[model samples]
Structure formats: C-alpha cells, structure tokens
Target: MEPVMPKDPEVHSAPAAVEMSEAAAANEEDPAHPETMAFCPTGWLPHGHRCFKLVSSDRWGSVEENCAALDGDLAGAETMDDYNDLHTLAQFFGHTYYWIGGFYFQGVWRWIDGSRFIYNNWHSQNSASSYPCIALRGAGGWVNTNCGYSYPAICVKRAC
Candidate 1:
C-alpha cells in the first residue's frame, strides 16, 4: 500500500471523506460540539480513530503534562497503521526523538494511558534499558532515553 502523507503538515484527517464533509458542515453550524471536534481539532492530524499533534521539544514530563492539559497523552501505536501515521507526521517535521506513551515502569513496558503494551519497533542495540520513557527514533523505530532530556512529543487521543 502507498504511504499516506499529509499535503499540509498543519492538518490531516481520516479517509472518511464524505463523513468528514458532513462533519465540517456541522462544525460550521455548531463549533462547540464534541462530535464536531472529535476527529481532528483545528491544527491536529487525524488517522483512523485518533487525532495527533506534535509539540516542540521539552522534557518528557513537561511534554506529557502539556498533552494532559490538552486532554491527550503521549502517543502510542499498537498497529502498523498507527505507527505509519505517526511516522509520516514525524517525517514531515524532520523530528527524530518524538516522545511516545510507552515507558519502562515496574519491570515492563506500558502506555501512559494504561493500555496494554503490545507492538514495539525498538532499535537493535542497547534499547532495552532502565530508562523511564521511550522516544521514536529517526525515520521509523524507537529508542530508550532519559525522561529528563528535552525532546519533541507526539500527543494522541481518541477520535470521539
């Protein structure tokens, strides 16, 4: 399958074109409705059933904090489609270490949202470390890193 890339880095949406058109019109009518803002907010990118946003580099804690303030959490991908969407967004901005939701806590990898820790694309090296958080590596993989180090982040939440 061809990789999906956003024509504009500032926005993206799921492939449901007709539904999106209807939603857009409804959004015009009732801008405050949660349904209207469910898929993708004004500046966020949408894929499948979630919306994503890439924030500027900051310490891991701060990044996650910002996402929480916006009602999101650090991004996590359990499927290839999810990974592809996030990877494409990262490519658009040329970011290498965007913080994701996975973290090493209590001897296992877990998502910040408490979702089951399932798929992973860790780089083949010293990736299995005691670092508290994981960051997406350049291109399309992951690396363990210090949570205190400043790095960009990918925030994600359900699409309503």
Candidate 2:
C-alpha cells in the first residue's frame, strides 16, 4: 500500500523510550530494571537514543515490511550527526547504499514516519526528478531513487 500523506507535514518526534523500558521491565528475563533495559533489542545495535537494525534486501517494500514487523520505521536521520552515525553503521555492514525514511510525495520530501525534514545530505545529482524514495550513499551522501528499486534498509526506533 502507498503511504498516507499527512494533511500538514509536521515534524515527528520518536516516541519516548520510557514506555519501552517499562514494558521490558515487566519481563523477568528482560533485565528486570529500567536502567539495564536501555539497550536495544537483542540483535539490534544502539546509537544515541535509538536502536537500528540492518535488514538486508534488494527490494524497498521488503525492507519496509521488515522494519514494520519490528514495530519501527525506516531510519530517518534528521541531523547531520544522525546521518554520520547511520552512515558509519551502514559502512560497517558493507553496504554502499542503504534505504532511509525520506521520500518525495506530492513534490515534497517527507520522512515516512512524519519526522521533521530538517536536514539533507543529498548528492548533487539527487535533485533531478520524480524518484519517490531516498538512499544514503556510503560516503554520507543521499540520492533519490525509484521507490520500487531494491536496496538494504536501516530500521530505526526508540532504544530499549
């Protein structure tokens, strides 16, 4: 299904992680304390206040599906610092390019999860046409692409 466009493109903030901590704290095998539960899910790696999971795929939809299944959305780097961190992580995974959450809809670039479109790392060639999705190059640049094209994805969500 195509993503729903918000009537007004307000910035989206990640849900607070305290809720996740509370949930995990309820599980006996899940650390038993809020402080200890701050880590990301078992297989996911942590950076700052978020957890990111690299899901390998050659298809954008598959990557979106995987991220949704984990109760997260595609990683949207709203700051240069975030882009740097995600870029570093993607490099470690040996990916030359990886899907992020931004996409063009109705001529506007908006994050899939509705986060603020506060920053950009676009390559000079990225601004050309109607490609509706974005991928981050390993060198920390972004390019637009046809949404149907395949690429690995970085799923991101609140840590813990």
Candidate 3:
C-alpha cells in the first residue's frame, strides 16, 4: 500500500513520490530492533513488524494460518524477555519450521527489537553455522545458525 504525502509541484511533485515499500522504505527504519527491522536473511515475508515464511512449499498455509500456529504472532515483542515467550510458543505450535526475528546475517547480530546478539540462548553444542542469524531446533529452544540453511523462518510485526 502506498501512503500519499502532501506534495507541491515545485518543491515536491509526483516524480518525488516515494513508494513506502520494502526496498524503498528499507534503511529508513530506526536502528532499534535488528530482527524485523533488518533484512530478510532468510526467505520470509516482512509484514513491517513481523517477518513470516512458509514452513514448506505448502501453499495451503496462509500468513494467518501460520500466525494461528504461533503463540505470539501479531503481539510484537518488545525485549529479549518477550522473545523468550516465543520459546514456548514455537514448541507446541510449530509443525515443520517457523521463522523468528532474530539473526546475525550481516556479521553483526541483532534482534527484531534492535537488541544486539550479546547473549545467545542456544541450547547444547549447537553453534551458529552462519553469521548474524539464528534458529530454533524445534522444541530445543533457540540456536544460532546460518540463514542460508533451509529452516522455516518467521518475522515479528506490531499489532494493529
């Protein structure tokens, strides 16, 4: 959806019209949460606040359907503590795989809330295969992994 801003012929015109979309609007967001705010390190749909990806090639599953499977979909996580809540959510609800707004794909790790990947809660000997991205091994909690891996990814968005 394109939001029309007030414009003038000289100072601003239709030519100056900016498309508030992913590529155009990207980098315009604040340097807060790195997860949802950052680029889709993994193939997922960015609903601005939430990033979502299909579990498999299953077209039967819609964004709402994926959201329905998650305990915290549109709620919007504010802090690491809030992300902690997703642990339980991903446990029982996820089927094949789900995306989370936490990764370090760009060398510098960050969360959807803009928090740096300072403290990782990865379980056991699991390590980050790729830089700047992480994933959850089903009910095994979170793991720092490469975004290149074939994992079902999810994103976080604000609740309207």
What lDDT does the true structure give each of the candidates?
A: 0.66, 0.67, 0.41
TM-score of every candidate: 0.70, 0.71, 0.41
Write down the RMSD of candidate 3 (Cα, Å): 18.4
Best by TM-score: 2
Model 1, 83-151: lDDT tens per residue?
Answer: 777787678656556788888766678888776668878763243454667788657787666777667
Where does candidate 2 stray beyond 4 Å? 1-38, 126-129
lDDT of 2 by residue, 84-129 (tens): 8888876766656777888776667888877657888876334424
What local lDDT score does residue 72 receive in model 3, on the 0 to 100 scale? Answer: 34
lDDT, residue 149, model 3: 41
Q: For candidate 3, lDDT tens digit of each residue in 26-64? A: 433345744445443233333344443334211112322
Q: After superposition, how far is residue 158 of candidate 1 from its true place, in Å?
A: 1.9
Give the C-alpha miss distance for residue 98 in model 2, angstroms. Answer: 0.5
- The global Cα lDDT (0 to 1) of model 3 is 0.41
